[model samples]
Structure formats: C-alpha cells, structure tokens
Target: MTPEELTRPWPPPTPKPAERGAPPTPVPSAVPRRRLLRWAAVGAILVLLVWSVQGTGVSVGALIDGREGGLHLVRGFLHPDLSAAFLADVGSAVLQTVQISLTGLLLAAPLGLAGALLIAGNVGAPGWLRGSARAGAAFLRGVPDLLWALLFVATIGPGPAAGALAIAVHGAGLLAKLGAEQLEAIDPAPVEAVRLTGTGRAATAVLAIIPQARAGLASLLLYQWECNLRTSTVIGFVGAGGIGQELAISLRLFRYDELSTLILAVLAMILLVDQLSRVIRRRMGAAT
Candidate 1:
C-alpha cells in the first residue's frame, strides 16, 4: 500500500432514507401551566361540593332516617279494608282519572302539532306567527302542572273538567317541544322534493315531514299519556277530581290501611300504562 492511501481518513456512514430530508421531531414537554390549573380547579370544586353537601345536612344519616320513616309508614299499609262502599269509591275514582288523562291527551295532540309546525324552520308559517306560537308553547311549558290545575280549579270549580284542562296545557307544551325537535330533524330533501312537485308548504309538511316524523310523534304522544296519568292523580289535590283527594283524606285521617290500598292501585295503574306504552313503542319501531 502507498503511504498516501494509508494516510487517508475513513468517511462517515450515510443517513437512512427516512432521515435524509426530514426535519427534527420536537420532543414532548411536561404538562403545561393550563393543565395544572385545570387539575387544581377540579380539586377545589370537589372540596367545595363535599363541604356544601355536609353543610346543608344532606348526609347519609338523613337517608337512613327517611328510610326508617318510610318503613314504619309502610307497616300500617299492609292490611286494607275491603268494604263495598270503599271499593266502589276507588273504582269510580280510578275511572275518572283515566277519563281526565285520555281527554286531555286527545285535545293536546292537534294543538301541539300545530305549535311544533309553527316553530319548526322548514315548515313554519309567517315569522311573527311562528314567534307567537313558540312564545305560547314556552309560556305553557314554564308553568308547572300543579299550578295549571289550581288555576283551572279556581276558574271551572272543582271537577274533572279542570283537571283535564290543566293536563292539556302542560301536555301541549311538552309535546310541542318534542315534536318540533322531531320536525327539525326530518329529511329536508323530501320536503324540497315535494315542493318541486308544486305542492304548497302545508301540503309538503303533511306529505313529507309528517310521514318521516310520525314515529317520533307517536312515541311522544304515548309518553305524554303516561305522564298525564301521573299528573291526573295529583290534580285531585285542588279538588279537581281523582283518587288523590281520597288518598289525601285518608292520610289526613290517619287511615293508613285505606291509603295503602290507594297506593297499590296507583302502582298497578302505572305498571299497566308502562307496559302498554312499551308494547305500542315496539310496534311503532317495527312499523318504521
């Protein structure tokens, strides 16, 4: 070997293809100040929540006390009096409650649909008209069912009519909100297609939107029906007719036996309605 070749320095190895034109990847840093602040805030909130709950006397002891009281009360309800007059009165009261809920729900459906249509952007009427409808629905919804029942009781005198009207008002508002949501979520393409066929807005809604929204609408209606049943029981508090008045009277008299009977009856009614609603909902799902 020549002395010049022996003196030459060795060359460094070539870089990989991936590393040739690539920029240096930045290294990940530690958690930022914002993240630390967030964790601190969360810890502070948890501390405040625990303190507030304890300060307000909302403790495990309160729950235990409530459970004990309920158990004691339930003991008296174990035996029920089966007098003929009492049974008849209960039957009549239950029938009255059913009538109130059904009548109210029926009256509410059309009004709620109209309100929903007016509030929905795709099928709303004139701007001011739509605004009025939405305002009416909001007003009705904001008022509690009990308040409406009391108001109707004052106006119409204590009876089933008052109770029915109260349920109608609240039910209409709730149904309107749900129905409007359903209407808004409907397929707009169908609506446009119907319009292209020279159909009017009302006609387009009837043909296009209603068909698609019918399932949700029906479900909402059944849900309202279930709710109204529960509401009807309480409307009797204002003397607007139902089993609730009798239950209240029995409680006032400390007739725990009779009260138990009423409670059981109400429980049965609720379970029945729930089962019926479930069946109908399933059928609706199948149809769709």
Candidate 2:
C-alpha cells in the first residue's frame, strides 16, 4: 500500500453519525394508564373496606375474639344424640326434605321449560307471549318460596305438598330465566337454517335450539335440585313441612347435641350432592 493512498481519506471517513448519546426507550402502550388503574382499584377497595367497617359497626377483629365460644359451640358436635328413636325421627324428616325437593323439581322442570320457550326470543313467540312469560317469571322469582309456602299453607294447609308447590314456583322462575338466557346466547345460524327448510317453530326449536342448550339446561336443573334440597330444610320452619320442623322443635328445646347431629346430616347431604354434581358434570363433559 502506498503512503499517499493510506493518507487519502480511506472510503471517506464516514463521520460516525455524531453520537446522539443513548437512544430514548419508547414508552410501553399503556404502562402509565395501567399503573393509574392499579392505584385507582386499590384506593376503591380501601374505601369500601373503610365504609363497610364504619357502616356495619362490626369490627372484623371482634369475630376472632370469640375463639373460645366458637370452640365450645363446635365441640358440642361430639355429644350428638344417636338414640334409635331420635334417629328414626331424623330419618323421617330427612325423607320429607327429599320428597319436597324432588317433587318441587319435577314440577318446576316442565313449567320452566315451557316458560323458557315463551321467553326465548329465538323461539319467535309473539311479543305479548314473551312479555307475559317475562312477567310470570318475575312474579314467581320476586316472591320468595317462604311467601309461597305461607300462601299454600293458608290455602291448602301445611305439608310437603305446600313446600313442593312453593319451591316449584320459585324454581320454575329461576329455570325459565336461566334457560331463556342460555337459548339467547346460542348460535342463530342453525335456527335460521332450520327455519329456511319450512320447519315449524316447535320443530326448529327442538332441532336447533333445544339440542344446543339441553346439556346446559340439564345442569341448571341439577343445581336447582341441590338448591331446593337446602331450601326445603329452611321452609320447614314455616310449616311447609320437613325435618326443619323437627329442627325447630329441637332448637326450642335447646338440644344442642341433637342440633349438631341434624346440622351435620344436612351438611353431609349438601356435600354429597355437590360431589355428585361435580361427577355428573365431569362425566357429561367427557361424553360431550
């Protein structure tokens, strides 16, 4: 290489683009907004907590202060009266509870399905029919089962029948609302296609909508069964008839041990039903 060639600006010394220090990091899309949102949420929760504490006038700490009493109450479970006669009575009451629950569900299922058909917009029912269905559901749901039980108790007298009727009406309303919602959310393509074939409304619903929502509706029915079971025990106090009446008697007498046994039985039943529901859902899911 010649000295002159070396001295010549070699490929014209490309002036290192005047070092503009470090390149600025671009801000993320919503970092500040997210941070602001996070703080806002935290503040809202703290405010709610404070409001609850002030409004309720019940300090959360006080709940723990009764640890000794709580333990004493819980320990009463140990002395549950297991006499044959007591158990027999309990069994009878339990049967009553089951009878009310199952009977009510039976009555509710069909009524709810009918109401759902009327309520479901996809069913293409007349506007007046839909409105009537909505009104009926609202009426049923708005009135608690206890109130219904009272009405039945007055009209037909107190028994499992009254309880069944009460729960059935309430369950019908709930099922109707839920079923309608489920039908509403279903894909319209199949229904439209069925309609295109000159199918009747009933045929279209059975083929398209009902099939799509059958599984979901069945699950809802099962859940309602569980709810009705629990509720029957409660309505028993109102003389709708069940072990709840026995429970009230026991409570009146302050038979804590008996109460413990009854409570445990109820708890066991609920847990068993819950487990069964989970199993059913799992099996259904697998089958589907």
Candidate 3:
C-alpha cells in the first residue's frame, strides 16, 4: 500500500447513496399504513365525542343562564342544618348505614372467597363447577344493587335487612371476579412445589395459593366495603333504610339544608374509609 493510504483512518465513513448519485431507498408501505390507522382512530374518537356532546344536549349557554339557581343551591349547601335534634337523627342514620355495610360484607366475604376458589384456573376445581360459579357471579354482578334492594323490599318489606342483603348479593359477585383474577396471577411455582409434597388439592391451595394472594384479596374486600357503604346509602332511597332514605325525604320536603348535611356526612365517611384502606394496604405491602 501507498504511504498516504497506510496513514489513513482504519475505518472510514461511507458516503450516502444520494451523494454517490444513487436513488434513496423506498420507504416501507407498513409505516404509512400504521400512520393512516392512527389518524383514522383519532378522527373516529373526535367524531364520537362530538356526536355524544350533541346527543346529551350539553350546553354552556344553558349553564350560564341558570347561574342564579345554581348560586342558590350552593348557598343552601354551604349552610347545612346543625340543630341538636337533626344532628342526632343524622348520627343515627349514619350508624345504620355503617351497620348495613358491615352486615353485607360479613355475609359476602365467605361466599365470595368460595366462589373465587371455585373459579380460579389454578385451583383444580371441576371445570363444570368453575363455569357454573363464574356464570352465577356474572348474573349477580349484572343485576345492580339498587335492583336487588327493590326486589328484597318487595319480597320482605322495606328495612335495613333489605339494604344489607342487596349489598351482599352485589358485592359477592364483584369480590369473586376480582379475587379469582388475583388468585390466577399468583406465583405458580409455590403451588407446584406444595403439590409435590403430597399435599391434596385443597391443602395445596390453602398452603400455597391463598397465602400469596391474601394481600390482594384483603385489599379487594376493603374496596368492596367502601363500595357497599356507598350502596347502602343509595338503597335507602327505595325504602331499604339508611341515610339515603333521609336524603330522599329531605329532597322531597325541599329541606336543602338537611340534604347538605347528609351529603357532607357521606363525603366524610368516604374520606375516612379511603384513608383507612390506604393505610391497611400500605402496611400489608410492607409486611409482604
């Protein structure tokens, strides 16, 4: 080799094809197709949003025109009734609501856990049994808690019992579905190892599966309790008995101040439950 060639860089940069007087490589068709699909999806979403807004009669102008009425409502909410007698009644109703939620959760927990065990794929339950349990859970979930409350009220007469039963029936379905998913997501290795130790099917599940999934199951139950508490309040509107009944009465009598008090109570209950659930979940995660 020549002296200049030997002194040159070991790895030299190559010139571009265009610089070499050659045509650029053609772009792939798939790239343009993907971009087209993305734009189409965005356009479809925009169209659906516009259609929904028009169908729902959403109007900023109407909202602006009703400002006075809105302000009046706001003022009433800001000035909740705090009389001693009313406060006593409110406290009682709140307690009843709590009772209903607890009763429902107690009834639902075992039923839900059993259903979850049956439906979980890794549990080795009979296929038919799993399918049946899943179907039953679906049916329960399909029927709203309000409808359940209505049914119980018609059959057993209106009271806290009806509300509790409604919450239980609906919550069982939710818990079963959620718990099954959690169980299915657990580490299969532990389950397999437990089985190899001559443990029976049920024993294996008890020893291996449940322990791993317990944290998730506990969190689900807490969430369900929060939901049950909210549902108990609403079921009272149908005469099932709770703070919701009082809310309905207040609204019918144009007792906006009382209504405001009930709303605040509900909000406070929700916040308390949320905080408690958060703390429990944090502690569980730390323990795990």
Candidate 4:
C-alpha cells in the first residue's frame, strides 16, 4: 500500500493492444460436390423406378386408355351367366373348392404347429434339430404352391386329392414356421413356471405355451385358409380338379360369359372368406 508502488506505472504495466474489431464472422464454404451428390442420388432413384416401370410395360397412359375396357369387363361380371345349368356347374365347383380349403386347413394345422414348435425352438430340441426343421419349412415355403400341386398331380394323378395334398404339405410347413415364431416370442415366465411345477414337457407345452400362443395359432390357421383357397384355384389350372379347371376350359373355349361368371363366383368366395376371417379374428382378440 505504499504511495510509490501505486504511482510507479502500477509497478510493471502490461501493454494491451485495443481489441481488433471482432474476428471476421465465419462464412461456410459452399459444397457443390455434396449438393451434386444429393441431387444425383435422387435422380438415380427416379431413373431406376422409371426404367423398372417401363421395362415391365406398366404404362399409366395405356392403363388410362383401357379403363373403358376394364369397366365393360366389370359390367359383364355384374351380369354373370346365372342360368340354371351354369348355376349347377358353379355350385359343384364351389363345393369342391371349399372342401379342398377346409380339408387342407385341417390337415395343416397340427403338422404346422409341430413344425413351428421344432423350428421356432419352442421345443427343447438341439440347435441342429431346430435348424433342420426350419430349413425344411423354408424349402416348402420357397417352392411355388402351383409347383407343389403339379408334383402331386404328376405323382398321384390329377384330382381334388392331389390339390388337397399339395395344399396340406405347403400349409403345414407355413403354419409350423409361423407357430414356432409365435412360440419363441411368448412370455417365458409361464413356461418356466410350468416347468417348475413338475409338469411334463407335453403338459407344459399344451397348458402354458399353447394357451398363450392360441391367438397366433388361430391367426396362422385363418391365414393358411385364405392361402389354400387361392391355391385351390391354381390347382384347377393343372387338372388337380377345382373351379380353376373349369375356368381354364372356359378360357380355352372362348366362353367369356361363363369365364366371367366363374371369376365372379371365385371373387365372391374370397371376399366372403375374408369377411368371416376378420370377424373371427376380431372376436378372438376381444375375448383375449
């Protein structure tokens, strides 16, 4: 606090330069390359989509031009051949189709459930066993349903029997795969509790696992039913015996009226099935 210290340029004053005006604000450099890349990527995707549509002959303009033809066709279907004779044939064909679907679904359900259990690792199998089951299911799924029907036809001769068997085989594999996955994703707590209760494997699976997975099981069955219905149509094409056979014959004979009627009938059947399935599923979900 001496007077001299205070007065002696504060002992040793530091020279400070005045603040140079604020350093120039940063200006981002333009990235032409990045912008170009973004635009190029968008352009490339557009080009690819356009080329795909063009290659497939999917011309929107042409579709628009043919809209009237489509309308006429639809009108023809609305006034389908409802003659008594044709009606009899339609009734018979429809009965065959339904029979095939129901029978196939029945056959597929248990088999599919078993396959799913094995493949989805719900069953206490070794990894290799599970893998093999899964692989087999995948193989079945990979083959076209028509191919399966053809194989059955070639081997066993053409008929509803061939159709049913083909559908059954494929349906089993599909349902099994789905069921197995549903089993895999279930609440393990119940399964563990079942085990802890000294329950056998079969009891544990049936009571603890199956109940929990019932919704998925039902859904899979219903889905397979839908698929089987479509499949039955295809089998008819190969003489596996269904409305499809009649359809093929009608087409070959240029029986446009009959063909239209048949198509309408098939469409009605599909729509009815779809509605019924939806209702059933809704009821199930609600009950659960």
Residue-level lDDT of model 3, residues 43-152, one tens digit each, is 99999999999999889998999999788778889999999999999999999999999999999999999999999999999999999999999999899999999999
Best by lDDT: 3
Counting clashing residue pairs in each candidate, in order, gives 0, 0, 0, 2
How much RMSD separates candidate 4 from the native structure?
A: 4.7
lDDT values of the candidates?
0.89, 0.89, 0.93, 0.85
The weakest ten consecutive residues by lDDT in model 2 span 14-23
**Candidate 2 lDDT, 1-288, residue by residue in tens:** 888888997577654444655566776789889999999999999999999989987876777997876776667777898989988888888888989999999999999999999999999999998999999998999998889988999999988899999999999999999999988888999999999999999899999999998888888888999999999999888888888877887777877789888887788878988899889988987877
Query: What TM-score does model 2 achieve against the real structure?
Result: 0.77
lDDT of 1: 0.89
Q: Write the residue-wise lDDT of candidate 1 on 1-25 in tens digits.
A: 8998787776756788676988678
Off by over 4 Å in 2: 1-72
Supply the global lDDT for candidate 4. Answer: 0.85
Clashing pairs in 2: none
Which pairs, if any, clash in model 3?
none
Give the C-alpha miss distance for residue 49 in model 2, angstroms: 7.1
Q: What TM-score would you give candidate 3 relative to the actual structure?
A: 0.85
